[model samples]
Target: MLVQETLEFDTPGRGSTDITRRVTEVVRAAGMTTGLCNVFLQHTSASLMLCENADPDVRRDLEAFMQRLVPDGDPLFVHTTEGPDDMPAHVRSILTGNSLNVPISDGRLALGTWQGIYLWEHRTSRQARRVTLTIHGE
Candidate 1:
């Protein structure tokens, strides 16, 4: 069996939004006993991640690391049409990636105890993002 769905999320600027529950809901709705789920983000300024859900500090630290690694308004980039965060957002997205593949077991996401899905908004301004999920299995 195969199932596909698109989900939209509104991000409040640069931060991580927990989306594990939403994805799990989709998996459950699909009724796939075992398979693979592919989560694909449809934006260059944002990316998806599976990170530690037990602590917010881990996310904050990750953001800090990204900010330092790819600081906004850095002259190294010239694609500043959307302001300082524009080009950096794309870079961040590339570094983090835009999709995830998780195994489905017993009609649920096979994530670790501390693992959670996140939509990481790289831009500095609020924006709407879309994520498309594709699941296939028996």
Candidate 2:
């Protein structure tokens, strides 16, 4: 059987925001055991990842690195209809990721002790984003 759910969030920039608890909730509700859980982000400017959840500095530094790597505004990009941040956002997403797969056991996500799921928003504004979660198992 497979179960699915959608999660929404408002983001500020290209950084990680923990969503592990939400995924766990969906996994428990699905009642799936020993299966695969896939989490996908619906937008191109955003992505998903599993990262260290215990440290806020990690996220901050990651955001800083991305900003430096993809700094806003480039005359080379023609798809800047939304502004300089638009093209940079797409690049950031490509560099990061868009989905994640995790193991499930006893109706719970089997994440590492310090790991957590995150939605890596690459946009500059606090726009609403959607994430799709799918759980497949017996």
- Who wins the lDDT comparison? 1
After TM-score superposition, what is the CA distance of residue 17 in candidate 1 from its true location, in Å?
Answer: 0.4
How high is the lDDT of residue 44 in model 1?
93
- For candidate 2, lDDT tens digit of each residue in 1-138? 988899888876556778888888889889877899999999998878788889888888888888888888977788998889999899988888899999998778989899999998888778788999888997
For model 1, residues 1-138, the per-residue Cα lDDT tens digits are: 999999999999999999998999999999999999999999999999999999999999999999999999999999999899999999999999999999998878999999999999999899999999999989
TM-score of candidate 1 to 2 decimals: 0.99
Error of 2 at 62 (Å): 1.0
State each candidate's clash count.
Answer: 0, 0
TM-score list, all predictions: 0.99, 0.93
lDDT of 1 at 9: 94
Off by over 4 Å in 1: none
Q: What is the C-alpha lDDT of each candidate?
A: 0.96, 0.86
Clashing pairs in 2: none
